[model samples]
Each structure stands twice: as C-alpha cells, then as structure tokens.
Target: MNAWSGRQAPSLEDFEEMALAALEGLPAPFRDLAREVTCVVADFAEDEVLEEMQMDSPFELMGLFVGIGMAHDGAAPVTGQMPNQVFLYRRPILDYWAENEDTLSDVITHVLIHEIGHHFGFSDDDMEAIEADAETEH
Candidate 1:
C-alpha cells in the first residue's frame, strides 16, 4: 500500500485543536500574553473580511489578528470592546500545505504563532525565536 493512504482533511474542530496545541507549546511569556486571545478556525475567510482586506481570493490570507497589540496604546479592556481574536483559515492553510514541504502540524503552528506574534507586537526575529523555542519544547 502507498504511504499516502486514504486520509481526510482535518475538520474545523481538528484545526482548532491543532491551533490550541501550538499555543500550549509556546514559551511561557508568549503563552501568557496569548491567554486572553481567542483562536478561531474557519474553512476560509468570510466574504466581508475579504472585502475589507481588499483580497480577491480567500487563499490570499491564511490567518489574521484582530484587536490592539500590547505595544499599542489603550490596549486595556474597554467596557464593551470585544476580546482579541486570531483567525486561522483552514482551507487556505491546507492548500498551502498540499503545495509546500512543511508538515500539516508545522504549517498550523507557524500560522498560529504568526498571528499571536501580531497580538504581542513582536518583531519577526522575536517570533522566530519563539518558534524555535517551541520546537525545542516539543
């Protein structure tokens, strides 16, 4: 039998689980900052979101960070402001994975951490270090 046996695409819930696992593997500091952020997994970007981002196709976006970052002013909670959220687009990520050299879990972790890095106003170097640390932990 071929190694690529019958395998179904991960469901939304599966994606969510993978995202959460990525969060759990983060360094302590990043994990603490991410505690208040919600991770949402969707098959693709919503049409409204696509319009707002000026994206012609959902595949153009793999993830998005919504809300103020810690480095910004007035990041504290307001009386009625919605909580911070990180959105992971499953279909696009899967498509990318299908065409890339990375494993599905690696792809999921990269997207999750990249979005969470935005939440912390982290630089690319900072995110890369965090990802490296996460890899060691696993």
Candidate 2:
C-alpha cells in the first residue's frame, strides 16, 4: 500500500489541539506572556470578518489576533472588555500546508506565533527570532 493510503485531513478538533501544542512549545518568556491569550480554531474566515478585512477570499487569512496589544494601553484589563484571542483559520492553513514545503505542525506553529506576536505588539522580525529560539530549544 502507498504511504499516503488511508490518510485524512485533520479535523477542527485536531487543529485546535495542534494550535494549543504550538502555544505550549514557545520559549519560556513568550509562553508566559502568551498564556493569557486564548486560541480558537475555525474552518474559515467568517463572512463579516472577510468583509471587514477587505478580503475577497476566506483563504486569504490564516489567523487573526483580536484584542488590545501590549503596546496599547499597556494591555490592561478594562471592565467588560473581551479577553485577548488568537483565531486560527483551519481550512486556509491546511490549504497553505498542501502547497508549502513545511510540515503541517510547522505551519500551524508559525501562524500561532505570528498571532501571538500581534498580542505582544512584536514586529515580524521579533517573531522570527522567537521562532528561531523555540526551534533551538527543541
């Protein structure tokens, strides 16, 4: 039998698990700050979200960070404010994974860390360094 036989795409729950694992795998300092951020996985970007982002396709967005970042208001908690959240679009991620050289776990980790970077108001370069640190620790 072919090595690919009987294989199937990961389900929503599986994606969630992978996302959480990625969060847990971050370096200590990043992981500590990221612990407060919630991770949510969905099949695709919602219509309203796509409209708001001026995106024509759901696949255009793989993940999003929702809530005030540390750079804004020191990330203080205000009354009635929603907790910080990182949303992972599973279908788009899987689609990207299908076309990329990276493994599914690596893709998921990248997206998760990118969103977490938004939560901490870190730049792309900072996130890249964090990812590199994580890889070295593993």
Candidate 3:
C-alpha cells in the first residue's frame, strides 16, 4: 500500500509537467493542434469564470477552454488577439483524483483532451472519437 507521507497537493509546476506529458502522448495531429494552445495550472477556477459557467463551487470545474475555436475563426486569431488557452484547476483536479479510481496522469489527459476539443469546436462525440483513436494508438 502507498504510505501517506502528508504531502500536499501537486504544485502548479507539477501540474504543468503532467500536462506537457499528456500532450506529448496524444496523436500527432491532435498534438499539433494543441501546440498553439497554452496550458495554465491554477489553484482554482477564477471567480469570474465560475460565475460565467454557473458553477456553485471552484471544485466543480476541473478545467476550462477559452478562445475562439477554429471552426468559428479560421484557425487563427486576428491581429492583437489572444490564442486559445486551457486552464486546469489544480485543486479541483486533485480533489477529483481523490474521489475517482483513475490515475492522476489519466485524469489530466482526459481533462486536457476535453478542453482541447472545445478549442477545436468539437462536439462531445467528436472528442470521444478522438480519445478512442488515441487509446488505440497506445
């Protein structure tokens, strides 16, 4: 059994490393798309984002996708515009890990892919299909 070492939740830097590894594990095409998107690891969802999502608590949001999707904006931002960003709430992800059976790496990958789907303007079914393809590659 794993001993409890009284370690705190993963830090932002740790989350960043995990997110990078998750991205690298994805298929080439998907990873290419994700390359343009920045990944941010924060302790919790911002208040404004929570209100926008209608979430009652910070823990309710594991991650978020922000920016104009390729389907809507021709796959590139106009002058002076920001590119896509995926915000992974570290605290929420840690909380979820504690309650779920999946490994931390798997959970991070799931969240990253789901958020990237939003960046691509993909439906849930599309995301599922992409994930399926990724699994088959391994």
Candidate 4:
C-alpha cells in the first residue's frame, strides 16, 4: 500500500502558495522567469517517470520539468507542448528534507530553479553557474 493512502496533505492552494514563495526567493533573472511559470505538486512520481528516469528508489527525485523551454520554437503551454510547468514530488521532497540538513523551502527553491532552468534550455554548466551565483548572493 502507498504511504499516503489515507494521510492528510496540505491543500493545493497551500502548496502553490509555498511554491510561489520559494520561487520569489530566487535570484533576479530566475525569479522573473519563475513568475511566468506554473508549479504543480503530485503525491509521488508517476510509474512512467520512475521507469524513464531509471529511479531505483521512489524518493530519489523531488521534481520534474514537463514542457518546452522559452528557447524552443513556440510558446510552451501549461499542460500541452506550449505551456511550461514544474512538477514537485511531495513524498520525495519531504523525505529528502527530513533526511538532509537543508530547509524544506530551500529544497523546494532548488527544485523549482532546476526545473525552470530546463524551461530556458539551460545547459548543465549554465545551471551550475546560475546555482553558484544564487548561492553567493544568498
């Protein structure tokens, strides 16, 4: 049975509010980009995501990006190919925060920024630099 089968969870509105605050705490350009993005929370990773991402453990990943970046040809839609979205995995994120030294909000912000990096077609190196910059600014 799933761990969350009967547990109470924060409401969708509450989760969104928290995510928005996390995004708002990011650095300049990223903060601006995140304002135009939508964040969605899921209880766990989808079966397909587990298989495709080759996740041996359910708690390995905390979030995902599912839409085209602004660097892509056309605008990304919030649900379809045109909209951009960030998917937060609740169980995994919570597990990570509980296991690690980072704060929940910090972890959420990292995941949020990482996913948004995809939206802007940022390369891994680019993301590293951006993260470093954010860290210094913080």
Candidate 5:
C-alpha cells in the first residue's frame, strides 16, 4: 500500500499546497482563468457562507465560490459577483476521506478544481472531458 493511504487532518498550509497543485494540473486556459482567485480553507462552513450559498446544511457544501465571472469582463465591482475565491470546507472533506479510500490530497484537489470549474461556467460534460484529459496527462 502507499505510505499515505488513510485520512488525516491537513494543516492549513498543507491544504493550500494540495489545492494549488491541483489547480496547477488543470489545462493552461483553465489555470489562467483561476489566476487572481484566492483559495481558503475552513474547518466548517460559516453561517454567512451557508446563508449566502443557500446551503441547507454545512455538510451540503464541501466547497464554494464567490466572485465576478470572466464573462462579466470586469465591467462592475464584485458587489454582484464578488471577488473570485475558492473555499474548501475542511471538516466535511475529512469526513468524506475517512469513509472513502481516496487520499486527502486527492479530495482537496477534486474540490478545488470543481469549484474553479464553476468560475468558467463549465458544464458537467466539460468538466468530465477536462478531467479525462488531465488523467491522461498525469
């Protein structure tokens, strides 16, 4: 078995690294779009985040984005779209890792890319194609 197979809590910095690395693995176009976007990690979803996202519960949101989309072309302040940010809800991630066989880093990466995919307005089909291409490259 691989050395790091089990679920363990990731330090804040560790989570950031894994998330960033995952972003780096995306296609150049997608990676460029992700630039200027900040990534944050939290133990749980905040009340405001929950309300803003309209999440029924903390568990419902494993990640989130709040920012102006590239489509807007910076015509207005983010009051309507907000700054681009990717939020990784740490606790729920750990919970999923514990129950599943995947490593924590992989989970973080998936969430990171998935949220960034939201920024591009990529459909599920687009994401699947991207993911397939990424798998082939890796």
Candidate 6:
C-alpha cells in the first residue's frame, strides 16, 4: 500500500490558507506597514507578468510584487490607482519546497516577506535583518 495513497498536491485554496497563515504570523510592525497590500495565490504566474518579468517559465517565479510601493509614492494613491498586491505562485512554491529541505511554512514566509521587501525597496541585507528579527519574535 502506498503510504500516501490518498494524498494530492495542495490546491490553490490550500496555498491561500498557507499564505494567510504566513501573513498573520508576521511581526506586527511589518504587518502594519503592509496593511493595505493585497496578497493572492495562484497556480502560476500570469502570462503577462512572466513575460514582463522576463522569466522563461512560470515556475521560475515564486512570487511577484505589483503596483506602486510606498517607497515610490510622492503622494497618496491617485483616484483610480489599484492597491498594491503580492502574487504568490503556488506551483513554483511547491516545486521549490519539494527540492529544498526547509519546512513548507518557512518557504511561504520567506516568499511573502521577500515580495514585501521589494515593495518597501529593502536591500537584501535589510531583508535579512528583518527576517532575523522576525524569527526572534516567533
């Protein structure tokens, strides 16, 4: 008998659950700063997004940050501007999880923060520091 006979790959809904849980676990300060940022989970990156980002495959992109970041705003949102968004690519994240030793939650949290880091125009070093700080709180 297969030990995982009834198991199936995590659905988009499952990924959404993970994404929300990851977001909820973030430090209050960081979460507050990203309060307005919307996050969505999809099986793959949209074709246009992949093309724009110059990726050969959707699996190459784990997540994406879209819309104007706070760091770029000289003023508040314009009348018709869309809210900032983070797109988490499920298939790619699953693939990445499969190939790495890290736990699934860690992967999700990393991707979430990395995208948010881009929104805040954080450097790699800054992100690392933030990640380290967040870890200490957990």
| Top model number, lDDT | 2
**RMSD in order of candidates:** 1.5, 1.1, 1.8, 5.7, 3.8, 1.5
Per-residue lDDT of model 3, residues 1-138, tens digit only: 556777777779988999888888888898887788998889998899999989999999999988887878877678888878999988899999999998898788889889999888888998888777766775
Off by over 4 Å in 5: 1-8, 52-56, 72-82
Q: Quick one: ranking by TM-score, best first?
A: 2, 6, 1, 3, 5, 4
**lDDT on C-alpha atoms for all candidate structures:** 0.88, 0.90, 0.86, 0.77, 0.76, 0.86
Q: List the residue pairs that clash in candidate 2.
A: none
Q: Which residue pairs show backbone clashes in model 1? A: none
Each candidate's number of clashing pairs is 0, 0, 0, 6, 1, 0
TM-score of each: 0.92, 0.95, 0.91, 0.74, 0.77, 0.92
Write the number of the candidate with greater lDDT, choosing between 1 and 2: 2
User: What's the lDDT for candidate 4?
Assistant: 0.77
Better by lDDT, candidate 4 or 1: 1
Mark the regions of model 6 whose C-alpha exceeds 4 Å error after superposition. Answer: none
Model 5 C-alpha lDDT per residue in residues 7-80, reported as the tens digit of each score: 45677777777777877877777677678788888878899888987888788788887776565554244446
lDDT of 1 by residue, 1-138 (tens): 876687788999988898888888888988987898899999998999999999989999999999877777445776787888999999999999999998888888888889989988888998899888888888
Q: How many clashes show up in model 4?
A: 6
Model 2 ranges off by over 4 Å:
none
Write the number of the candidate with greater lDDT, choosing between 2 and 6. Answer: 2
Q: C-alpha displacement of 49 in model 5, angstroms? A: 2.0
In model 2, where is the ten-residue run with the lowest total lDDT? 70-79
